[model samples]
Target: MLVILVALLWFTTVEASHCSIMARLSLMRNISELSQNNYGRPDLSHTTIVGSVLHGIKEIEVWLQNFAPGSSTPIHRHSCEEVFVIVKGQGTLYLTPSSHSKYPGNPQEFHIFPNSTFYVPVNDAHQVYSLP
Candidate 1:
Protein backbone atom coordinates (compact mmCIF):
# COMPACT_ATOMS: atom_id res chain seq x y z
CA MET A 1 0.00 0.00 0.00
CA LEU A 2 1.27 3.46 -0.90
CA VAL A 3 0.48 5.91 1.86
CA ILE A 4 1.37 9.52 1.05
CA LEU A 5 1.49 12.54 3.30
CA VAL A 6 0.46 14.98 0.60
CA ALA A 7 -0.02 17.74 3.13
CA LEU A 8 -1.44 18.47 6.53
CA LEU A 9 -4.65 20.51 6.48
CA TRP A 10 -6.57 21.31 9.63
CA PHE A 11 -10.32 21.75 9.53
CA THR A 12 -12.25 23.22 12.40
CA THR A 13 -15.95 23.34 13.05
CA VAL A 14 -18.21 24.83 15.65
CA GLU A 15 -19.47 22.45 18.31
CA ALA A 16 -22.79 21.11 17.16
CA SER A 17 -24.78 17.97 17.84
CA HIS A 18 -26.47 18.11 14.43
CA CYS A 19 -23.24 16.87 12.85
CA SER A 20 -21.06 13.97 13.81
CA ILE A 21 -17.60 15.50 14.01
CA MET A 22 -15.99 12.07 14.27
CA ALA A 23 -17.76 10.60 11.30
CA ARG A 24 -15.42 8.74 8.98
CA LEU A 25 -15.73 7.51 5.44
CA SER A 26 -15.69 3.78 4.83
CA LEU A 27 -16.90 3.03 1.36
CA MET A 28 -15.68 1.38 -1.82
CA ARG A 29 -14.77 3.63 -4.72
CA ASN A 30 -15.00 2.49 -8.32
CA ILE A 31 -12.31 3.74 -10.66
CA SER A 32 -14.52 3.47 -13.73
CA GLU A 33 -17.10 5.71 -12.16
CA LEU A 34 -14.60 8.30 -11.01
CA SER A 35 -14.17 11.49 -13.04
CA GLN A 36 -11.10 11.89 -15.22
CA ASN A 37 -9.29 15.12 -16.00
CA ASN A 38 -6.69 15.95 -18.66
CA TYR A 39 -3.12 16.82 -17.89
CA GLY A 40 -1.74 20.36 -18.24
CA ARG A 41 0.37 19.48 -21.27
CA PRO A 42 -1.55 19.27 -24.51
CA ASP A 43 0.82 16.66 -25.92
CA LEU A 44 -0.18 14.37 -23.13
CA SER A 45 -3.27 13.40 -25.06
CA HIS A 46 -2.79 9.81 -24.05
CA THR A 47 -2.99 10.63 -20.38
CA THR A 48 -6.06 11.10 -18.21
CA ILE A 49 -6.49 11.80 -14.51
CA VAL A 50 -8.96 10.15 -12.17
CA GLY A 51 -9.44 12.36 -9.11
CA SER A 52 -11.84 12.59 -6.21
CA VAL A 53 -12.36 14.09 -2.76
CA LEU A 54 -13.16 11.63 0.02
CA HIS A 55 -14.63 12.27 3.47
CA GLY A 56 -11.91 10.80 5.67
CA ILE A 57 -9.11 12.08 3.44
CA LYS A 58 -9.31 15.59 4.85
CA GLU A 59 -5.60 16.28 4.99
CA ILE A 60 -4.75 14.31 1.86
CA GLU A 61 -5.85 13.79 -1.71
CA VAL A 62 -5.86 10.59 -3.79
CA TRP A 63 -6.26 9.88 -7.46
CA LEU A 64 -5.23 7.66 -10.34
CA GLN A 65 -3.79 8.47 -13.75
CA ASN A 66 -4.09 6.44 -16.92
CA PHE A 67 -1.32 6.62 -19.49
CA ALA A 68 -1.28 5.12 -22.93
CA PRO A 69 1.79 4.03 -24.90
CA GLY A 70 4.05 6.95 -25.90
CA SER A 71 2.19 9.23 -23.52
CA SER A 72 4.49 11.61 -21.70
CA THR A 73 4.00 14.55 -19.35
CA PRO A 74 6.15 17.65 -19.21
CA ILE A 75 8.45 18.03 -16.23
CA HIS A 76 6.44 19.63 -13.46
CA ARG A 77 6.44 20.18 -9.73
CA HIS A 78 3.73 20.42 -7.09
CA SER A 79 3.64 21.93 -3.64
CA CYS A 80 2.61 18.57 -2.20
CA GLU A 81 4.36 15.24 -2.60
CA GLU A 82 3.03 12.81 -5.17
CA VAL A 83 2.58 9.05 -5.00
CA PHE A 84 2.42 6.80 -8.03
CA VAL A 85 1.26 3.23 -8.37
CA ILE A 86 1.58 1.20 -11.54
CA VAL A 87 -1.59 -0.78 -11.28
CA LYS A 88 -1.30 -1.99 -14.85
CA GLY A 89 0.98 -1.88 -17.92
CA GLN A 90 4.59 -0.81 -18.17
CA GLY A 91 6.26 2.59 -18.28
CA THR A 92 9.38 4.65 -17.64
CA LEU A 93 9.72 6.99 -14.64
CA TYR A 94 11.78 10.13 -15.16
CA LEU A 95 13.35 12.36 -12.54
CA THR A 96 15.52 15.42 -12.76
CA PRO A 97 17.50 17.36 -10.21
CA SER A 98 15.97 20.72 -11.06
CA SER A 99 12.51 22.12 -11.71
CA HIS A 100 13.72 24.67 -14.26
CA SER A 101 12.97 24.47 -17.97
CA LYS A 102 16.39 23.00 -18.74
CA TYR A 103 15.98 20.58 -15.90
CA PRO A 104 15.99 16.79 -16.16
CA GLY A 105 19.55 17.05 -17.38
CA ASN A 106 21.28 13.79 -16.53
CA PRO A 107 17.80 12.56 -15.79
CA GLN A 108 17.28 9.30 -13.99
CA GLU A 109 15.10 6.64 -15.56
CA PHE A 110 13.37 3.67 -13.98
CA HIS A 111 11.48 0.69 -15.34
CA ILE A 112 7.90 0.68 -14.06
CA PHE A 113 5.80 -2.48 -13.99
CA PRO A 114 2.43 -3.41 -12.62
CA ASN A 115 1.97 -3.43 -8.83
CA SER A 116 4.89 -1.05 -8.47
CA THR A 117 4.74 2.04 -6.27
CA PHE A 118 6.94 5.14 -6.37
CA TYR A 119 6.94 8.64 -4.92
CA VAL A 120 8.07 12.16 -5.81
CA PRO A 121 8.99 14.65 -3.14
CA VAL A 122 7.31 18.03 -2.74
CA ASN A 123 8.47 20.52 -5.39
CA ASP A 124 10.64 17.85 -6.98
CA ALA A 125 10.28 17.89 -10.75
CA HIS A 126 9.41 14.61 -12.46
CA GLN A 127 7.52 13.10 -15.36
CA VAL A 128 6.17 9.79 -16.60
CA TYR A 129 6.75 8.31 -20.06
CA SER A 130 4.60 5.43 -21.10
CA LEU A 131 5.97 2.47 -23.07
CA PRO A 132 4.41 -0.24 -25.15
Candidate 2:
Protein backbone atom coordinates (compact mmCIF):
# COMPACT_ATOMS: atom_id res chain seq x y z
CA MET A 1 0.00 0.00 0.00
CA LEU A 2 1.14 3.54 -0.71
CA VAL A 3 1.28 5.67 2.39
CA ILE A 4 0.57 9.22 1.38
CA LEU A 5 2.34 11.84 3.45
CA VAL A 6 0.62 15.20 3.65
CA ALA A 7 2.30 18.36 4.85
CA LEU A 8 1.54 22.03 5.16
CA LEU A 9 4.39 24.44 4.47
CA TRP A 10 4.47 27.99 5.73
CA PHE A 11 6.91 30.27 3.92
CA THR A 12 7.73 33.48 5.71
CA THR A 13 8.27 36.22 3.15
CA VAL A 14 5.95 38.31 1.10
CA GLU A 15 5.30 41.82 -0.16
CA ALA A 16 3.35 44.26 2.01
CA SER A 17 1.34 45.68 -0.85
CA HIS A 18 -0.34 42.34 -1.44
CA CYS A 19 -1.89 42.37 2.01
CA SER A 20 -5.65 42.66 2.22
CA ILE A 21 -7.87 44.22 4.83
CA MET A 22 -10.65 41.70 4.41
CA ALA A 23 -10.46 38.19 5.69
CA ARG A 24 -10.21 35.22 3.34
CA LEU A 25 -10.79 31.51 3.68
CA SER A 26 -9.12 28.74 1.75
CA LEU A 27 -10.57 25.28 2.14
CA MET A 28 -8.20 22.38 2.29
CA ARG A 29 -8.73 19.87 -0.47
CA ASN A 30 -7.83 16.23 -0.77
CA ILE A 31 -4.32 15.50 -1.99
CA SER A 32 -5.50 13.64 -5.05
CA GLU A 33 -8.12 16.27 -5.78
CA LEU A 34 -5.81 19.26 -5.85
CA SER A 35 -3.44 20.00 -8.68
CA GLN A 36 0.03 18.63 -8.04
CA ASN A 37 3.34 19.70 -9.54
CA ASN A 38 6.60 17.81 -9.15
CA TYR A 39 8.63 21.05 -8.98
CA GLY A 40 11.39 19.30 -11.01
CA ARG A 41 11.63 16.46 -8.49
CA PRO A 42 9.85 13.26 -9.42
CA ASP A 43 9.41 12.10 -5.86
CA LEU A 44 7.77 15.26 -4.55
CA SER A 45 4.66 17.14 -5.56
CA HIS A 46 3.24 20.36 -4.11
CA THR A 47 0.34 22.74 -4.57
CA THR A 48 0.09 26.31 -3.41
CA ILE A 49 -2.68 26.79 -0.90
CA VAL A 50 -2.30 30.48 -0.24
CA GLY A 51 0.00 33.12 -1.69
CA SER A 52 0.23 36.12 -3.99
CA VAL A 53 -0.99 34.10 -6.96
CA LEU A 54 -4.00 32.67 -5.20
CA HIS A 55 -5.00 34.75 -2.18
CA GLY A 56 -2.70 37.75 -2.48
CA ILE A 57 -1.30 36.86 0.90
CA LYS A 58 1.48 39.31 1.69
CA GLU A 59 2.81 37.97 4.95
CA ILE A 60 3.22 34.32 4.15
CA GLU A 61 2.76 31.57 1.59
CA VAL A 62 1.02 28.31 2.41
CA TRP A 63 1.45 25.05 0.48
CA LEU A 64 0.19 21.51 0.62
CA GLN A 65 2.68 18.80 -0.24
CA ASN A 66 2.28 15.09 -0.83
CA PHE A 67 5.11 12.61 -0.89
CA ALA A 68 5.00 9.13 -2.26
CA PRO A 69 6.35 6.25 -0.26
CA GLY A 70 10.09 5.62 -0.58
CA SER A 71 10.44 9.03 -2.18
CA SER A 72 12.64 11.89 -1.13
CA THR A 73 13.12 15.54 -1.93
CA PRO A 74 16.34 16.91 -3.35
CA ILE A 75 18.83 18.69 -1.11
CA HIS A 76 17.83 22.33 -1.39
CA ARG A 77 18.03 25.68 0.40
CA HIS A 78 15.97 28.79 0.28
CA SER A 79 16.18 32.41 1.46
CA CYS A 80 13.08 32.33 3.69
CA GLU A 81 12.60 30.30 6.82
CA GLU A 82 10.28 27.32 6.31
CA VAL A 83 8.07 25.42 8.69
CA PHE A 84 6.43 22.07 8.04
CA VAL A 85 3.38 20.59 9.68
CA ILE A 86 3.00 16.90 9.02
CA VAL A 87 -0.59 15.74 8.94
CA LYS A 88 -0.17 12.11 8.08
CA GLY A 89 2.41 9.35 7.59
CA GLN A 90 6.07 9.61 8.65
CA GLY A 91 9.40 10.85 7.29
CA THR A 92 12.97 11.73 8.06
CA LEU A 93 14.50 15.17 7.76
CA TYR A 94 18.16 15.63 6.88
CA LEU A 95 19.32 19.13 7.72
CA THR A 96 22.70 20.75 7.23
CA PRO A 97 23.21 24.04 9.03
CA SER A 98 25.72 25.61 6.69
CA SER A 99 24.20 28.95 5.86
CA HIS A 100 27.47 30.70 6.55
CA SER A 101 29.79 28.10 5.05
CA LYS A 102 30.72 27.62 1.42
CA TYR A 103 29.80 23.94 1.39
CA PRO A 104 27.05 22.07 3.21
CA GLY A 105 28.59 19.73 5.74
CA ASN A 106 27.25 16.40 6.94
CA PRO A 107 23.54 16.50 7.64
CA GLN A 108 21.77 15.63 10.86
CA GLU A 109 18.79 13.33 10.60
CA PHE A 110 15.52 13.76 12.49
CA HIS A 111 12.52 11.47 12.29
CA ILE A 112 9.15 13.12 11.81
CA PHE A 113 5.79 11.51 12.53
CA PRO A 114 2.20 12.54 12.22
CA ASN A 115 1.17 15.71 14.05
CA SER A 116 4.77 16.76 14.39
CA THR A 117 6.30 20.05 13.24
CA PHE A 118 9.78 21.04 12.14
CA TYR A 119 11.45 24.31 11.24
CA VAL A 120 14.28 24.99 8.79
CA PRO A 121 16.46 28.04 9.11
CA VAL A 122 17.08 30.31 6.17
CA ASN A 123 19.67 29.00 3.68
CA ASP A 124 20.05 25.70 5.50
CA ALA A 125 20.28 22.78 3.11
CA HIS A 126 17.73 20.07 3.84
CA GLN A 127 15.95 17.05 2.40
CA VAL A 128 12.91 15.05 3.48
CA TYR A 129 12.21 11.39 2.78
CA SER A 130 8.96 9.50 3.14
CA LEU A 131 9.25 6.34 5.15
CA PRO A 132 7.49 3.22 3.92
Candidate 3:
Protein backbone atom coordinates (compact mmCIF):
# COMPACT_ATOMS: atom_id res chain seq x y z
CA MET A 1 0.00 0.00 0.00
CA LEU A 2 2.80 2.38 0.87
CA VAL A 3 4.51 1.63 -2.40
CA ILE A 4 1.32 2.16 -4.33
CA LEU A 5 0.69 5.43 -2.51
CA VAL A 6 4.20 6.61 -3.36
CA ALA A 7 3.74 5.74 -7.00
CA LEU A 8 0.40 7.51 -7.06
CA LEU A 9 1.88 10.53 -5.36
CA TRP A 10 4.71 10.73 -7.86
CA PHE A 11 2.43 10.15 -10.78
CA THR A 12 0.11 12.88 -9.56
CA THR A 13 2.92 15.36 -9.03
CA VAL A 14 4.10 14.85 -12.55
CA GLU A 15 0.58 15.02 -13.90
CA ALA A 16 -0.30 18.19 -12.03
CA SER A 17 2.91 19.98 -12.96
CA HIS A 18 1.53 20.40 -16.43
CA CYS A 19 -0.85 23.07 -15.16
CA SER A 20 1.59 25.60 -13.74
CA ILE A 21 5.15 26.89 -13.96
CA MET A 22 5.93 26.71 -10.24
CA ALA A 23 4.67 23.20 -9.94
CA ARG A 24 6.80 22.24 -12.91
CA LEU A 25 9.95 23.68 -11.40
CA SER A 26 9.47 23.22 -7.69
CA LEU A 27 8.26 19.78 -6.75
CA MET A 28 9.89 18.96 -3.47
CA ARG A 29 9.86 20.06 0.17
CA ASN A 30 11.92 19.87 3.31
CA ILE A 31 10.90 19.06 6.90
CA SER A 32 11.61 22.54 8.25
CA GLU A 33 8.76 24.18 6.35
CA LEU A 34 5.80 22.37 7.80
CA SER A 35 3.31 23.88 10.25
CA GLN A 36 1.67 21.95 13.02
CA ASN A 37 -2.04 21.98 12.14
CA ASN A 38 -4.98 22.39 9.79
CA TYR A 39 -8.17 23.85 11.28
CA GLY A 40 -11.27 22.92 13.32
CA ARG A 41 -14.10 20.46 13.39
CA PRO A 42 -16.45 20.59 16.38
CA ASP A 43 -15.55 19.31 19.88
CA LEU A 44 -12.10 18.07 18.95
CA SER A 45 -8.70 19.63 19.43
CA HIS A 46 -7.35 21.61 16.51
CA THR A 47 -6.70 19.52 13.42
CA THR A 48 -3.06 19.73 12.46
CA ILE A 49 -1.22 19.10 9.19
CA VAL A 50 2.31 19.43 7.90
CA GLY A 51 1.93 20.07 4.22
CA SER A 52 3.88 21.92 1.55
CA VAL A 53 1.56 22.47 -1.27
CA LEU A 54 2.91 22.22 -4.73
CA HIS A 55 0.15 24.76 -4.77
CA GLY A 56 -2.13 24.72 -7.80
CA ILE A 57 -1.51 21.10 -8.63
CA LYS A 58 -4.25 19.64 -10.69
CA GLU A 59 -6.44 16.91 -9.19
CA ILE A 60 -4.25 16.25 -6.15
CA GLU A 61 -3.45 17.79 -2.82
CA VAL A 62 -1.38 15.98 -0.21
CA TRP A 63 -0.80 16.64 3.45
CA LEU A 64 0.50 14.87 6.50
CA GLN A 65 -2.19 15.11 9.17
CA ASN A 66 -1.78 14.34 12.84
CA PHE A 67 -4.45 13.74 15.45
CA ALA A 68 -3.95 13.99 19.15
CA PRO A 69 -5.83 11.55 21.28
CA GLY A 70 -9.56 12.40 21.38
CA SER A 71 -9.44 14.50 18.23
CA SER A 72 -11.72 13.53 15.38
CA THR A 73 -13.34 14.71 12.21
CA PRO A 74 -17.00 15.56 11.95
CA ILE A 75 -18.62 13.22 9.46
CA HIS A 76 -18.14 14.64 6.01
CA ARG A 77 -17.79 13.90 2.32
CA HIS A 78 -15.97 15.37 -0.61
CA SER A 79 -16.80 15.54 -4.30
CA CYS A 80 -13.52 13.74 -4.89
CA GLU A 81 -12.29 10.66 -3.01
CA GLU A 82 -10.14 11.37 0.04
CA VAL A 83 -7.38 9.10 1.29
CA PHE A 84 -5.94 8.72 4.77
CA VAL A 85 -2.77 6.88 5.67
CA ILE A 86 -2.26 6.38 9.39
CA VAL A 87 1.42 7.21 9.77
CA LYS A 88 1.19 7.02 13.53
CA GLY A 89 -1.09 6.25 16.45
CA GLN A 90 -4.49 4.59 16.38
CA GLY A 91 -7.97 5.63 15.29
CA THR A 92 -11.41 4.50 14.25
CA LEU A 93 -12.62 5.06 10.73
CA TYR A 94 -16.37 5.50 10.33
CA LEU A 95 -17.74 4.57 6.94
CA THR A 96 -20.73 3.99 4.65
CA PRO A 97 -22.83 6.96 5.55
CA SER A 98 -26.57 6.26 5.39
CA SER A 99 -27.77 9.04 3.20
CA HIS A 100 -26.88 12.03 1.08
CA SER A 101 -26.13 13.88 4.30
CA LYS A 102 -22.85 15.64 4.88
CA TYR A 103 -22.68 14.13 8.34
CA PRO A 104 -25.38 11.72 9.31
CA GLY A 105 -26.58 8.33 10.62
CA ASN A 106 -25.01 5.20 12.09
CA PRO A 107 -22.38 3.85 9.75
CA GLN A 108 -19.94 0.94 9.79
CA GLU A 109 -16.68 1.55 11.58
CA PHE A 110 -13.18 0.09 11.58
CA HIS A 111 -10.18 0.39 13.84
CA ILE A 112 -7.06 1.81 12.20
CA PHE A 113 -3.47 1.63 13.32
CA PRO A 114 -0.17 2.99 12.08
CA ASN A 115 0.73 2.69 8.38
CA SER A 116 -2.78 1.84 7.38
CA THR A 117 -4.35 3.40 4.31
CA PHE A 118 -8.02 3.95 3.58
CA TYR A 119 -10.14 6.27 1.55
CA VAL A 120 -13.62 7.71 1.77
CA PRO A 121 -15.43 7.03 -1.45
CA VAL A 122 -16.47 9.91 -3.61
CA ASN A 123 -19.52 11.57 -2.05
CA ASP A 124 -19.62 9.06 0.81
CA ALA A 125 -19.65 10.45 4.31
CA HIS A 126 -16.84 9.33 6.58
CA GLN A 127 -14.69 10.38 9.52
CA VAL A 128 -11.67 9.35 11.58
CA TYR A 129 -11.76 9.49 15.35
CA SER A 130 -8.38 9.45 17.07
CA LEU A 131 -7.89 6.94 19.83
CA PRO A 132 -6.58 7.55 23.27
Candidate 4:
Protein backbone atom coordinates (compact mmCIF):
# COMPACT_ATOMS: atom_id res chain seq x y z
CA MET A 1 0.00 0.00 0.00
CA LEU A 2 2.82 2.37 0.79
CA VAL A 3 4.55 1.64 -2.51
CA ILE A 4 1.36 2.20 -4.49
CA LEU A 5 0.62 5.50 -2.75
CA VAL A 6 4.14 6.78 -3.34
CA ALA A 7 4.06 5.79 -6.98
CA LEU A 8 0.80 7.65 -7.56
CA LEU A 9 2.08 10.81 -5.92
CA TRP A 10 5.33 10.68 -7.86
CA PHE A 11 3.58 10.31 -11.21
CA THR A 12 1.24 13.20 -10.40
CA THR A 13 4.12 15.48 -9.58
CA VAL A 14 6.04 14.56 -12.72
CA GLU A 15 2.99 15.14 -14.90
CA ALA A 16 2.33 18.53 -13.35
CA SER A 17 5.91 19.63 -13.94
CA HIS A 18 5.77 18.52 -17.55
CA CYS A 19 2.59 20.49 -18.11
CA SER A 20 4.11 23.61 -16.68
CA ILE A 21 7.15 23.31 -18.91
CA MET A 22 5.02 22.84 -22.00
CA ALA A 23 2.91 25.88 -21.06
CA ARG A 24 5.97 28.03 -20.75
CA LEU A 25 7.26 26.98 -24.12
CA SER A 26 3.95 27.79 -25.78
CA LEU A 27 3.87 31.20 -24.12
CA MET A 28 7.35 32.05 -25.31
CA ARG A 29 6.49 31.05 -28.83
CA ASN A 30 3.39 33.24 -28.89
CA ILE A 31 5.20 36.25 -27.53
CA SER A 32 7.89 35.90 -30.16
CA GLU A 33 5.35 35.74 -32.96
CA LEU A 34 3.47 38.78 -31.70
CA SER A 35 6.67 40.78 -31.53
CA GLN A 36 7.11 40.26 -35.26
CA ASN A 37 3.64 41.68 -36.00
CA ASN A 38 2.79 45.37 -36.35
CA TYR A 39 1.67 46.53 -32.90
CA GLY A 40 0.30 50.04 -33.57
CA ARG A 41 0.27 53.13 -35.75
CA PRO A 42 2.23 56.38 -35.60
CA ASP A 43 0.36 59.43 -34.30
CA LEU A 44 1.18 62.92 -33.06
CA SER A 45 -1.01 62.52 -29.98
CA HIS A 46 0.61 59.45 -28.37
CA THR A 47 1.99 56.15 -29.44
CA THR A 48 1.79 52.67 -27.99
CA ILE A 49 4.79 50.69 -26.92
CA VAL A 50 4.95 47.72 -29.20
CA GLY A 51 4.76 44.26 -27.66
CA SER A 52 4.54 45.69 -24.15
CA VAL A 53 3.50 42.37 -22.67
CA LEU A 54 5.30 39.07 -22.56
CA HIS A 55 3.53 35.78 -22.67
CA GLY A 56 2.86 34.08 -19.29
CA ILE A 57 3.18 37.46 -17.55
CA LYS A 58 -0.14 39.30 -17.31
CA GLU A 59 0.40 41.33 -14.19
CA ILE A 60 0.69 44.64 -16.04
CA GLU A 61 -0.36 46.22 -19.31
CA VAL A 62 2.04 48.72 -20.85
CA TRP A 63 0.95 51.58 -23.10
CA LEU A 64 2.25 54.85 -24.44
CA GLN A 65 -0.72 57.13 -24.44
CA ASN A 66 -0.46 60.61 -25.99
CA PHE A 67 -2.83 63.23 -24.74
CA ALA A 68 -3.96 66.18 -26.83
CA PRO A 69 -3.93 69.58 -25.14
CA GLY A 70 -5.83 67.80 -22.36
CA SER A 71 -6.14 64.04 -21.91
CA SER A 72 -6.24 61.61 -19.05
CA THR A 73 -6.67 58.03 -17.99
CA PRO A 74 -9.74 56.78 -16.18
CA ILE A 75 -9.67 56.09 -12.43
CA HIS A 76 -9.32 52.40 -11.78
CA ARG A 77 -7.40 49.72 -9.91
CA HIS A 78 -5.22 46.92 -11.12
CA SER A 79 -4.86 43.38 -9.85
CA CYS A 80 -1.13 44.01 -9.77
CA GLU A 81 0.97 47.16 -9.63
CA GLU A 82 0.69 49.71 -12.44
CA VAL A 83 3.47 51.96 -13.66
CA PHE A 84 3.71 54.91 -16.04
CA VAL A 85 6.48 56.84 -17.71
CA ILE A 86 6.27 60.23 -19.35
CA VAL A 87 7.61 60.00 -22.87
CA LYS A 88 6.26 63.38 -23.95
CA GLY A 89 4.47 66.43 -22.55
CA GLN A 90 3.93 67.44 -18.95
CA GLY A 91 1.23 65.69 -16.92
CA THR A 92 -0.32 65.60 -13.47
CA LEU A 93 -1.28 62.60 -11.36
CA TYR A 94 -4.15 62.72 -8.89
CA LEU A 95 -4.41 60.06 -6.23
CA THR A 96 -6.89 59.34 -3.43
CA PRO A 97 -6.41 56.49 -1.03
CA SER A 98 -9.10 53.86 -0.83
CA SER A 99 -8.92 53.83 2.96
CA HIS A 100 -9.10 56.26 5.81
CA SER A 101 -6.31 58.79 5.94
CA LYS A 102 -5.22 61.84 7.89
CA TYR A 103 -6.02 64.01 4.89
CA PRO A 104 -9.52 62.51 4.63
CA GLY A 105 -9.87 62.02 0.87
CA ASN A 106 -7.71 64.92 -0.17
CA PRO A 107 -6.06 64.59 -3.53
CA GLN A 108 -2.33 64.58 -4.08
CA GLU A 109 -0.90 65.91 -7.32
CA PHE A 110 2.38 64.98 -8.98
CA HIS A 111 3.90 66.97 -11.78
CA ILE A 112 5.58 64.69 -14.30
CA PHE A 113 7.83 65.62 -17.19
CA PRO A 114 9.54 63.84 -20.01
CA ASN A 115 11.33 60.59 -19.13
CA SER A 116 9.88 60.39 -15.62
CA THR A 117 8.62 57.03 -14.40
CA PHE A 118 6.13 56.44 -11.61
CA TYR A 119 4.73 53.38 -9.89
CA VAL A 120 1.29 53.00 -8.40
CA PRO A 121 0.56 50.23 -5.96
CA VAL A 122 -2.06 47.63 -6.65
CA ASN A 123 -5.67 48.39 -5.69
CA ASP A 124 -5.11 52.15 -5.35
CA ALA A 125 -7.62 54.25 -7.23
CA HIS A 126 -6.12 57.13 -9.15
CA GLN A 127 -6.35 59.30 -12.26
CA VAL A 128 -4.04 61.25 -14.56
CA TYR A 129 -4.40 64.40 -16.64
CA SER A 130 -2.11 65.85 -19.26
CA LEU A 131 -1.19 69.54 -19.31
CA PRO A 132 -0.38 71.67 -22.28
Computed on alpha carbons, the lDDT of every model, listed in order, comes to 0.55, 0.70, 0.56, 0.48
Considering every candidate listed, which one attains the maximal TM-score? 2
Ranking by lDDT: 2, 3, 1, 4
Candidate 4: 10-residue stretch with minimal lDDT: 1-10
Q: Rank the candidates by TM-score, best first.
A: 2, 3, 1, 4
Model 1 over residues 1-132: C-alpha lDDT tens digits? 111112222232423332242254225656466554555643332212211233433444455555557776577877666777667777787876555555546768888777787887666678777785
Q: Give the range of the ten consecutive residues with the poorest summed lDDT in model 1.
A: 1-10
Candidate 3 residues 1-132, lDDT tens each?
Answer: 111121012124244334465645445656346453345433332222212234444544555555567777677766666677676778788897545666556889898877788877667777778886
What does the lDDT read for residue 81 in candidate 1? 64
Better of 1 and 2 by lDDT: 2
True-vs-predicted CA distance for residue 2, candidate 3, Å = 17
Q: Could you tell me the lDDT of residue 36 within candidate 2?
A: 68
Give one digit per residue, the lDDT tens place, for model 4 in 41-109: 222233223221322232223444555556566776554556665666777888776523445376678
Error (Å) of candidate 2 at residue 16 is 10
Q: How many residue pairs clash per model?
A: 0, 0, 3, 1
Whichever of 3 and 4 has more TM-score, that candidate is 3
Q: Lowest-lDDT window of 10 residues in candidate 2?
A: 1-10
Task: Please state the error at residue 80 of candidate 1 in Å.
Answer: 1.5
Every model's TM-score: 0.59, 0.70, 0.64, 0.53
Q: Model 2: runs farther than 4 Å from truth?
A: 1-34, 39-43
Candidate 4 is scored at a TM of 0.53
